[model samples]
Target: MRRPRPKRGERRIDAATDHLAQYGFAKPQIRNVIHDLLQLYGRDGWVFLEEGSYPMVLNRLLEEQAQQDQDEDGSTITDE
Candidate 1:
């Protein structure tokens, strides 16, 4: 009887799979969200950034929102 053989250049990533299986949680609903996030990871504006300060990002976003609100409010007053 002939035995099944692995494909060429097919490297085994046992550690990676093990790590994901070990630490990664995938509850019923969580699985879907994880899949969606993975799909968005490589898309435009959804870059895979490993290092960034969450607080800094939050502050920047808040500042941008404040600036946008100010611009809109100021523009309306000048036209009034």
Candidate 2:
């Protein structure tokens, strides 16, 4: 059987949760971060995902995290 669609607000929350999961964020922290991002960025934050910008956000976050890791390691990474 097909699944039912989530209500509007619930859909955003669910998307936030899913986005967090995709980036390896734990549930408890995911809830908080999603809430904060939504609050700070407002509806545009959720809308961006619907418009297919979710992957862009995820990629940016991943790149930032990788840079942080490199900084911590004190070694520079060379791109091929």
Instruction: Point to the candidate with the largest lDDT.
Output: 2
lDDT of 1 by residue, 1-80 (tens): 99666564341222222323343322332334334544665443223321242232233344555677988888533554
The residue pairs that clash in candidate 1, if any, are: none
Cα-based RMSD of candidate 2: 7.5
- Write the residue-wise lDDT of candidate 2 on 1-80 in tens digits: 99999786576666766766776856565556556566777867767544563654555456667887999999996899
TM-score against native, each model: 0.29, 0.47
TM match of model 2 to true structure = 0.47
How many clashing pairs per prediction, in order?
A: 0, 0
Tell how far residue 77 is off in model 1, in angstroms: 13
Local accuracy by lDDT, each model: 0.39, 0.65
